[model samples]
Target: MSAADFLPRSSLSSLIDLLQQQGYRVVGPQVIDGAILYRPLQQADQLPAGIEQIQQPGQYRLIRTQGPRLFSWANGPQALKPLTFAPRETLWRSHLQADGSLRFEEVIETTEPTAVLGVRGCDLAALSLQDQHFSGDPYYQQRRDSLLLIAVDCSHPADTCFCASTGDGPDARAGYDLALVELDDGYRIRAGSPKGQSLMDNLPLDAATPEQQQQTDEQHQKACQQQRHLPAFEPSRLIHQGQHPIWDSLAEACLSCGNCTSVCPSCFCFSESEVPELDGTTSGHQRQWDSCFSEGHSYIHGHRFRPDTKSRYRQWLTHKFGSWVEQYGRSGCTGCGRCISWCPVGIDPLEALTELGREDVE
Candidate 1:
């Protein structure tokens, strides 16, 4: 098939079961504490349905929708980065015996294949960034190769998003195994790769008509038009404006809370720690997620490379927009507005960059 075939919503449910039966753990978004969190789902019933989240400069709220759609909403605060880079986990264990010999324990490898459903476009991009960082090195090849992605088209966008500007937005254009576009009564299901095709083949969905294809195209356009928030910065030109004074202004109001990094999908930096066992003689070495905004993040012998908030913020933005291309061959940000909406002071990256007049430096 040419990928225009539409699938019944019920077929999606069945396909999830089929994947589970095939030994792939199915994961999707579910509402928890008024926020969407991804967890293992046995069936599609657990999927968030008819719920649209209202997100703005500094807040997020869940609102009921008039229609029944699973993926008809803006990006949420939670990004999928932690699933691969684990927020906090023990790397290994060690013990000091009575003989004063130090013994080391081995770290077990995670070997599970996951099927992620309802992933947004920005999240997809974030995953792509992580893949480059993890898989590009021999250290993370096994974990990266075992995961599968199933992305959904965004029919709605938040007030603080401008993914359209970065060309990442409102839809999953690539980096997805299967891409689904929600219709009035069904879904326009299409396979981006062989794994997606295998899932479609196991289900019974209606073949998409020319009219449906047209609607899908039109709907995607309309979704992009509905967004009202985003920065005016042209991502391609960020390199030229790297040293601009605009970053200083944005850092003044910033509290350096690290909330944005915590919720970001592409922020993969981590820190290691050691925890002592009950016996006080044994300890485990653990690693936890660390943010560039943190004080101790750039700590050295007695100095911090990025002691100033302004410098740290600029460093983060530059790495995401400028240096990431050199490191991963792509921008680190997927245009997920979690950083904007979750900011207590309403720190919009787009607005900050534009205010600096760095939007079109190229």
Candidate 2:
């Protein structure tokens, strides 16, 4: 617990200006479609002010706050994944050559540099996992390399959140350049990298007092205590539990709509498409986010491995909690609980795990 620096609430907007001066498109939360959405933030006023989200399993609502608070909600539907790993992207395009040959070129987007403000600890953990998954992906690198991360601590954890159990956050622990804890009147900022240090040096900030630092720590502890959590289960259990009847129960209630994967910050399954012109001389290839629950995902040359809803659900659960550890040396889930909140059936993955792990499940 090093002494932190304080940034007055009013001067917070100046930090946005500093990032903008460095040619970074500052993105933060905004009220959109009756909920908070992360988008390009131009001014501080554009932040979701005087509003907070009340979230539970399969339910989300907004409430007018008694006071001014920019980021009171735990999360929106979107996470850092969409910002780095595109939902749909043109990977490459091939054209018919003049000499009856073909040529191919990669399609990498050259967009403005981005500074993600208000990143959560769980999302940061998810990004690190994705970095390993997409290490060789040029498009992902293109979006990730020039970006700066400024994480805001969750002072108010949602009922659906479980970052404490996941050890990812009630506050940012790693992978962020700068981490901020919001107070009633200002923010207590800490540096996690050289870029954060450099940015810290130039900002119009004051040294934080011991009382302010204590307040930040208290709020962080309170958030961890408030958020819901999952029962502890070893990663290896998920591998053996694949054949359990719990998967069948999950399938019965499951819609297989792929909503869980889309909302999960760490899910990285994708499918590619190729289109040809009428002349069949030129072709276009693109990639999009895919879910294991999708029927086509299990298809290979007209044979589907997990055709049934039960098997498909099993695949997603196993990959996320079991085989993922073997493949990547880490569990894929960060415990942000977006899956539970966004799932149409309100089917919580933890409940499935608990059911499958029971002594009688086998």
Candidate 3:
């Protein structure tokens, strides 16, 4: 359990075949629309092999690299959250019977055995947070229970990534079934759970050498060193600065479009509604992802609590970094940096939070 071994890169196809044979639909990063996105695949060849990514604040692009290396990209704007916690899903349905009686049918989510490959450690961290966030939610639980997490160490890091500062990544300690450190010749594989142990046992591999472990260590350290250094400011510290003028500056740069929340790995807010047939007989309840940045998200009985853009933006940043700890026993942001790349204006949460520590901010 402590040591790892090498899996010949050529035998990777066997792993995919094995997963497929076990009736698992493998979902992982693949090039789409000039960027990498998680998509289902039937073969290893379909994966974004030979692809590399370029990510920066408010920008993302994918380029073809020289060799056949899968999972060269760090991540796009998504994580495992969407695969388990769907963006839009029907909760249940009700229909009026011919005798005027009503019958309600529960919409149970189908659990397709899935294998999610190339999951980065930061995302594994986010998935852990979301697992706690949806503890008793049946829809989420069913889908999550069926996933086989194959986590890849973040050997390649983006400028926006700061998982090391959050104490969350570059490598994984928990939440993964299997963990991998990719090398040019093959991969160093370690089993994190019984499921992972079984898979590795079945695979053709050789005992790992000390040099391989050295390479893994070097790559991990290099990833940790690549993060854009963020100023140290505890999330709880922001709760006292309710009247800070940083809110106004954030509001100006923010479009209130809610792109950041949508792309975030840990944000789990949603709104529900009832939809009825035009004849008024059958109806279904639905839930869709919601953002606090929306104008109507804060509306109460007859008034919107946070009507202004500044108030909404403040709510989001504070909730993500500040109050989320009180709610979940940990900070909400995993430092994945999707919010920076996906935001239309590239609003960096790291910069915003650090600025709140300044004395000039009222």
Candidate 4:
């Protein structure tokens, strides 16, 4: 840790002004429909200040607090996934020609240069994974390149958080241009990239005091004391336990709603389809986010490989905790625990893995 710069909370709006002046669309967390979501910001006051989240398996709630800190909550339902890899996009379009011939055009949506604030460490890890998965993909690369990341360390982790167990965060480690630690009056900030350094040089910042640095360390320690965790077991163990009885038991309570994959920051499964307009003059080749829980995900040639909930659930768990390591050199889960907090039936993967590990010992 090095000496850092401090920005007064009142002057936070100036940061937004500077970014806008630099032709960057600033996106940040805000309360919408009772949930925190990332949206375009015009000023710092638009942030979800004095808001805290209470999260548990199958539950999420927001409550207003007396504190003035802006980035107190652990996380939200969405991550950087939507900002980079779109939920639905057209790859190309085919237009009917007057001469009875067809012409195809690739669709590359114009992207504005963006600066995202209040990013979390687990989401940063997930973004890195997505970067690898979409490597060399022009659409993803264009969005990835046209962005700046400003991460905030978690001062209040929810009960569903297991990022520490996954070796990801409560603090921003890497992959962010700038990092922030929110204190009572303002933020302690540091630069992690050249772009961040440039912004730091321009902001109305003062040298961080020792008291602010101590408070930042204490906040980080508090966040690290989270209750949830991934059990100690080789992730490969799940790959070999394909026929384990736990799958059947889990399927009994599972909804197969795909909420887990939808909220998972690192899940990259998708399905492509041809969407034709009613006039039939044009058709679009569309790619949409998909989940392994969907029966159609494994459907091919009229055969649904994972025909039941059991197989589908097994596929998801195995791929997330097992084969993903072989493919990406790490578990697919960053352990943000959105899947646990968002599941309708309160099906917790951490508990499921613990049960499996207990069975292995028995």
Candidate 5:
């Protein structure tokens, strides 16, 4: 840890200017279409100031507040996943040549160096998982290397959040260039990387006072006292529950709409296909984000392994909480609770897992 600096709320614009001057595209949370979305930000005013996100099972609402804080809310539906692992991208294109020889060209997207602000701790952990999964992938590496992560300690966690239990969040710990703790009139900022330190050097910042550091600690503690939690269960135990009846019960409520996976910061499933031109002159091979809940996800060799909603739901839960540990040394979930809040039918995975854990004990 390094000595922290204080930047008054008014000096936020100066930080943005510095990023732009360094030839980086600045993106941050903005109020758009009734939600806070990450978009290109040219100025500090574009941040969702005086706004708080109220989230619960199956519901998310934005409430206008009198507070001047910019990053008070816990999180939004999207995370750092979309920035590095693109939802839809062309891998390569094959063109028919005049001499009948095929020409295959890899499609590597050219991206501008970007700095994203207002990142939460859970998302930062999720991004680490993504980096591990996409290791050696050129497309993912290109975007990953070009990103500058600016994280904010979550002050007001939604009721659905359980990052405290997962040991991933509420306070920005690691994986960010810069971390911010929002105060009433300013922010307590610290650099986690050399790039962030360089930026801090350029900013006209004051040494963080003891009182401001105390305030930041209190906010982190408040966020940790959230309502939801993943149950105490061995991750490997879920692998044996394939035949459990809970799948059928969950299937009754699970729309299999894949909303949970979409909003989940760590869900990395994607499908690839080839698209041919009508004239057969050229074809493109592209990949897009996919979910285990989808029927086609289990389709292979003219047969679908997970034909019913029960099987599909079982696969998702088992893999996310069980087998993921074997592959990644941790559960797939970062405990951000996006899945619980975004599910249209309010299927809480934490509660479901608790039930399963109880069943195992019984």
Candidate 6:
């Protein structure tokens, strides 16, 4: 309901273990290949404890510091979407016997109540956008029912990030069970949901001091000031620019490699394949992440839809920034800038949108 503070880093590990004891799998940022990745963390020390990442076009690396603060790093190479919507899974399985008896089995649903520790604000917004697409729809309730989110403030942001302009963050606003703003010595923890309240009720914590509250406020203000500071565009106005020539021009440099969509925290498109046995009597279906940019993704009635790279690129950006709100009632881009940083051709979405804005003025 409100915020609290904890002084002990050792207790933080205990808290994680306590959550694990309560059957919640603790998911937090860990170091992998010089990048921060969301994975199961057994102790607070296992987290990229005091490491931050420096990111730029075609560059990403980690730098270490003294202290046990989390959220020290910037966003990672992979987005958060695949955590719930797994990139690869079996949809269902089929079996056929020699007697020609056919049977189909639906996969059993299994979910570990996940505690997402140190989720970045941009990722939180991406989850919000995904909620509209999945949880907002009645069909996706099953998946939404399983996650427990714990978001952390962005003490540091990369050069390419523009989430602040999008009203999503340098700090998380909603859709978290608990929100943490890290301090040099401790954490100012805010409970964002009843689930968090229940957990904190058992923990040894006290009401935040006025000074601690001020630190939280000041930390957020500083983070807001340090953003990439890209120009703002209203989400509602995105659609009106669909016919603008900026899409075609930007497509020229796009490799149509789908690198942007793949690394985006909100992109959820996928494809299905049938794994048939040698006897051809049985097969199981496998689901894998797919993108609109792939050539084989367009087969329809023996013909490809949106065959050209220009059209494919246009379709992706248009849906992500322009029409996604109408289609899913949310902004597709989370302002994560993974797309901008990870794109093979280094095409910047904000720059592209700004160019379109310039055309409107001209």
Candidate 1 residues lying further than 4 Å off, grouped into runs, are: 1-4, 136-142, 228-245, 358-362
Instruction: For candidate 4, write residues 136-166 as lDDT tens digits.
Output: 9998999999989999988889989989888
How many residue pairs clash (N, CA or C atoms closer than 3 angstroms) in each of the candidate models, in the order given?
3, 0, 1, 0, 0, 0
| Stronger candidate by lDDT (1 vs 6) | 1
* RMSD list, candidates in order: 2.7, 1.7, 1.8, 1.2, 1.2, 2.6
Q: How big is the RMSD of model 6? A: 2.6
Report the C-alpha lDDT of model 2 over 123-182, residue by residue, as the tens digit.
999999999999988899988987899999988788889889878988999999999898
For model 1, residues 239-322, the per-residue Cα lDDT tens digits are: 667567787687888899898889988888888889998998899998888989999999999999999898888878877766
Candidate 5 per-residue C-alpha lDDT over 1-362 given as tens digits, one digit per residue, 9 for 90 to 100: 34649998899899999999999999999988888889999999889889998898899999999999998788888898899999999999999999999999999989899999999999999999998999999999999999999999888888999988888988878899998889998988899999999999898898778888888788777778764677978788887888777787898998889999999999999999999989889999999999999989999999999998888888888898899999999988888989988999888888879878988889
Q: Model 1, clash count?
A: 3
Pick out the ten consecutive residues of candidate 3 with the lowest summed lDDT.
353-362
Model 3 misplaced regions, further than 4 Å? 1-4, 360-362
* Pairs in steric clash, model 3: 244-362
C-alpha lDDT of all candidate models, in order: 0.79, 0.86, 0.84, 0.90, 0.90, 0.76
Task: Output the worst ten-in-a-row residue range by lDDT, candidate 5.
Answer: 220-229
Candidate 6 regions with alpha-carbon error over 4 angstroms: 1-4, 98-101, 135-143, 230-249
Per-residue lDDT of model 6, residues 1-362, tens digit only? 25556545556776787789988888888888878788888888788777877777656778998857766766897656777677787777899977889899876466667777888778888877777666643323555677788777887888888788778888888888877777766776778889987777778776677877787788878777877765545545655666777777876888888888788998878899999889787788888889999998888999998888877876787688778878777668767788877877778778877776666566
Q: Residue 161 of candidate 3: its Cα lDDT?
A: 85
Clash pairs, model 6 backbone: none
